[model samples]
Target: MAQHWIATRPGDLEVFSFEPYDAPAPRSGEVTIEVRAAGMNPADAKHVARGRDEDFPRPIGYEVAGVVTAVGPDTEIGSGTVTVGDEVLAFRISGGWASEVTVAASAVFAKPASLSFAEAANLLLAATTAAEMLHVTGVGEGDTILVHGASGAVGVSVLQQAAMLGARAIGTASGSSFGVVERFGGTPVAYGDGLEQRVRDAAPDGVVAALDCVGTDEAVDVSLATVADRSRIVTIAAPDRAKDEGFIAIAGALPESQAYRDSVRADLVRLAGEGRLVVPVARTFALADAVEATELLMGAHPGGKLALEP
Candidate 1:
């Protein structure tokens, strides 16, 4: 038996109950992991809030770091690529908060030794989101990119990855978060009224691409004022505005985004292992304390990533 957190319904993270579940059995091309840590994201709760009308008592979590305990028939469990007892990180799995989970082998990767289980657990989704945004926006050398919500998980990743691509990052955040953005290699700008002017003053060379992580009208409006090319501006949030407005809207919910994530997932893991990427962890929670963690994730930016230890 194993334990996991379940939401009886959406919009009720605080009412969750941790319950016992049968150990998972892996099917072909799948593996069973004994979860060590699970990542907490706003999307985990928001997706449930969207509600499928079925799949009640939904298990909540997105990514986890763990040990492989079992593999399906015809699966090479002992292979160095993946093996029993080897530490690894897995993503896009349902019921990920459980003590054990069954996931497709293709979605698993070796966790870097440099990262703790908590940090490794938080890595994949945010890093992949950053990669997808930059790839779609065509950010590169000589480009001045504006990243809204630059202190959040995905925004920080965007700043670091943009720097890796030789692009200048102008990150918008509260004045308190300016240091965070600068550490990630972004020139920090305060986000508020007159955000456009602040960005303009920061990037005198002009902003060529914009990635909006905040999904507010302010972010969208400022992005438009700076980047003339609509194709060069994209928002992971504000899908409605993306449709009514001209800029691109990409999210994990979209088919294009799913394909894009599949292509670059492994590379992101590789970069982290090489120490070229760093994911800061603000806090960790016991699996049973997930409701508290969710509350924090849903409430405000915690200054870094949140993880749950199983």
Candidate 2:
């Protein structure tokens, strides 16, 4: 029997419960994974904490890296055909916080040998979100962008991806985390008082776009003060600000964002395979400690991505 984490009802960690489950054989266009590591994201907790009654008893994670245990007849993954015993990572999946899971084959992809199971498991969701932020804002070579919360998971990804786009990123982070932003190729600026001037000092003139990952009022206000084109200002964390201030707000749930993210997965995986992209994991927790793991994730200062090993 495989063990999996689930939420019995809408709430916080209090709702988490583990149960023994029999992972079914993969049907056509499906694949089963013996999960090695499960990716932890704020969405995993946010969705569960605010879910409707009908969403009860739902699984708790969206991505995992593991060995393929079974594949549907003639199943082909994102890059090519899939077979048992192959190392793989899957994203946008259901019930990934498990010892084993059966998911749609389309979500599966080749795991780069260069990355550990933990890193590979955590890659796509944040990377793809960063990619779409840059995409929607028209960021490109030689452009300058500002990133809020550059030391956090999604913010760190934004810094690396922005550099790869040949863009300079002025990142907002705490003083101690300045190294994290610089290591990822961003010019780090401390948050709090005088943030707007710090960003100006880093960029000299102004930034072409602003990507808000922290979603604080300071972040929103700074982005507004610096970037003239409101269309180029995007926030994944501050939906209320985006709605109220007339900037862009996107989520994986949005149809256009979903399509774009799905389209870019293979490319992001290849970048990792080439050792160009990196996912820094701050900590790992046992699968049984999912509630504790989620507490750290919600703490929002894990210093990097967190993973659950099953």
Candidate 3:
């Protein structure tokens, strides 16, 4: 028997329960893992917070890193062939808050030797989202962009990935989180009154795009005022604003976005493997402390990503 977390009913963290579970043999194209680390993100909780009655018994984690324990016959992992005992990471997996999981082989990739299990577990969701933002905005060499919530995980990824594309980022961050923005090669600006002016001053050459991780109206308004091309503006947080204003909004759940994210996972892993991309993990909690860790993640910035060490 293995242990895993689940939401017995739709609600908040109180509904989460850790229970004994039996992982079954993998079907074709499926693989089972002895989970080492499980990534924690806002969506893990938000997706189950409120939904239809039928969505109950939802799993609590989205990504994880582990050793491959079993594979369906003749299965090929996403990056290539995988064997038992292989160290790997998987994304878009259900019931990841467990000691073992059975997930589609296509979602698994070789874990980089350079990244700790915790870092690899925390990698894809935020990194792939950032990659999609940069792609849709047409960001490239010599481009300058504005990023909202730049200290957050997605925003931090945006800062680093933007730099890789030979683009410059002018990021909005709290006074305390300014270091994170600067460390990732972004120019940090306080996100409050006069934000538009602050961004302009930081990027005198001009901001060709704006990516919003923070959904505040201020973020939307400032982005609207700063970027000349509305089509170059994108938001992961403000879907209503995207519909109302006609820019762009994307989520991992959407088919197009999911395709884009899935396509880029291997490249992102390769980058991390080479130590070119970094996952800023702030803390790792024991499996039993997941609820407390999640409470903190939902509150003030923990300064970086959080993970569950199973």
Candidate 4:
């Protein structure tokens, strides 16, 4: 039987047994992947705890990287575009936290050979969210960007992407995590009392844009105070409040366009392949320790991207 982590109900992590069904052959335009590592994100726990659709026994996960074990019939991916045994990374509709997953060909990309399983798994969600924010807000070279919660996985991704685009990035993080932000090519400002003044000191000319990964009222208020164009400020965390405050808001659960996923996947893979991207993974858990992993991820301590290896 293939192993998978299933949350049978809200607020607990339990394993439900499953008989190994034959790996479903992909239909045309689909491909099957043998998952090596699953990226654990906050949304996974939130969905399991909150129960988004009443679909109990839900398999929760969004990003994975592994090898192509099978491809669907009549699909170009089967004919060497993505051959059997090709290493790949995928973003799935569901069931990513599993031993195997079937995804659309368009959704799977070649995993860079240079990346470890954990690093490859870490790329999808945070990197994709950062890419979408940059795209929708039209931030570009020479722009000064202020990023909130700059030490989290999404915050680090945003800092790297902004730097790659030739923009000046000023990131706000707790004093303990300031070094992380600075290592990713961002100017780090402490995020607390006098945050506005700290940001001004970092970017004397003023921040032209802001991306909020932390939903604090303080983050929102300081971003609003610093950026001249409210439309140029976007928030991924506090969508409701962001809307109330007139800043552009985006949610990973509800993105502006489907193509946004494709763009992020492409950019991330290319960057990792070329050694230009950094995926800081602070911890990894074995598949058997999934429950513990979830608990740690939910904790208040500082860490980078965490993954579960199977």
Candidate 5:
């Protein structure tokens, strides 16, 4: 029987047991995958905890790295582009925390041989979002960009991408995560009281643009105060508040362009393959221990991305 994690109500997580339904044969444009590792993000638990009032169970996860098990008829992705045992990373429209999943061929990418299932699983959403924000803001070589909350998965992706683009980057994190920021080639500044002054000192000349991965009032205020162009300042967090504060707001979870997704996947895989990217995995749990994993993910001081192995 295939096992899956499901949430039936707000703040509830349960392992639903079911008989092994025959794996669905892929349709014309679909591919079936045997999931190996599922990456969990904050949005997974938040969406479950704020479930719809009608009381329907919702399957949660969005990114997974697995092996292609089946391919649909009349599709270009025959057993060749991806084969029965070829490893792959997929970005599902919904419901990825399962023993198996069906996805559109477009959302699947060949997993780089250098990345483990765990690292591939963590790449899609966070890396894609960071790449999109950097692209949209026109951050390029020689530009100076500031990233708020520079220690999280998304934040680290931004720091790395900015550096690859030859831009000078300054990232803010708690004192403890400063080393992580620096490792990603960013000047690290401490957040909290006196945050603005800290950032100012780190990038004394001035910041040409800013990206807010943290969504705090301090982050917003500091960016607005330091950047010369508001249009160049973007926030992945606090979208509504960013609009009110006159900064560009982009949603990382829902990327607007398929090309953007492809670009992110390529960049993530390439950097990882070349040992230029570092995806820190703080903890891991078997699929059966998803509840405990989610709890730790929601708690403070759990450093790095968390993954679930199926």
Candidate 6:
């Protein structure tokens, strides 16, 4: 038996309950894992807070690192990519908060030996979001970009990936987190009342694109003032403002984003394995302590990733 978090209806983290489960035998092309660590993202809590379909008791997590325990019978042998006993990381897998999960073989990747289970579990979604944002904005060598909330998870990934692409990145952070942004190879600018002017001062050459991880009116206003092309501004945080605000928004709700994520999944895996990509785990809690971990994640910025160890 395994235990996992689930919500019967949307409300708050309090709506989630731990329930025991048994993994049914996987069908062909599926693999089952003994989840070692699960990564927590705002999306996990947001789904419950915003509500979902009438489906009761839906699983609550999205990514995890674990060891393979079973492989389903399949003529194609998709499980050949991994086998029983191999350590792995799986992303975008629904219900990943469980102590055990069965996922499509294609979604699992080899975990890098250099990274701990906590680090490997947190790498996918943020890094992939960063990659897709760069692609949609056409950011590349010689380009300069501004990243709103650059000290946050997605913002940190954006700064590092932008550097990997040979682009200059200017990151917005609280005065306290400026060092975090600078260490990731981004020019650090404090965000507040004069955010636009701060960004302008940081990038006198001008930024060609902007990625907004903070959905404030201030972030939108500044990006619009600096980047001539609205299409070059993308937000993973504020989807509601994207259409009316004339900026691009990529969310799981969009088909284009789903396809984009699928295409670039392998790249994120490779980057983490090569050590160019890093995920900083601020703290880890026992699986039973999910509520406390989640409260912290949903509250103020924690300076690093929060995860659950099963």
Cα-based lDDT at residue 280, candidate 4: 88
**Model 4 Cα lDDT, one tens digit per residue, 1-310:** 4577777777745533232434467888998888899898888887777774478867778888889888787665411378889998877457777788787887788888899988999887888888888887788999999999889988888888898889989999888998899999999999889999999999999999999988899999998999989989988878888768887888755645456765567767888789888898988888667778878887875379888887
> What TM-score would each prediction reach against the true structure?
0.96, 0.98, 0.98, 0.92, 0.91, 0.97
Q: Please report the candidate that would top lDDT against the real structure.
A: 3
Residue pairs whose backbone atoms clash in candidate 4: 26-72
- The residue-by-residue lDDT of candidate 5 on 1-310, one tens digit each, is 5666666667645533222334467898888888899998887877776667575566678888899888887654422376678898887446677788887877787887888888889887888888888987899989988899889999998998888899999898888998989888899988888888887887778889999887888888888999878899888777887778777887644657455666567657767778777778887789777878887887785788988898
Off by over 4 Å in 4: 12-23, 77-80, 255-257
Query: Global lDDT of each model?
Result: 0.87, 0.93, 0.93, 0.81, 0.80, 0.87
Candidate 1 per-residue lDDT, tens place, 1-310, comes to 8998887876566547799988668887889999999988888888877766576778888899999998887664322366678898887677788889888887888888888899889998898899999999999897889999999999999988898999999999999998999998999999888899999999998999999998999999999889989999999889898888888999887888988887787788888888888899999989888888888998877999998898
Off by more than 4 A, model 6: 75-80
Model 1 misplacement above 4 A: 76-80
TM-score-wise, the better of 4 and 5 is 4
Compared with the true structure, model 5 gives a TM-score of 0.91
What value does the lDDT take at residue 282 in candidate 1? 96
What local lDDT does model 5 show for residue 234?
A: 88
- Give one digit per residue, the lDDT tens place, for model 6 in 208-286: 9999988888898899999999989999887778888778999865799878887787778788889899898899999
Task: Give candidate 3's error at residue 54 in angstroms.
Answer: 1.1
List ranges where model 3 is wrong by over 4 Å: none
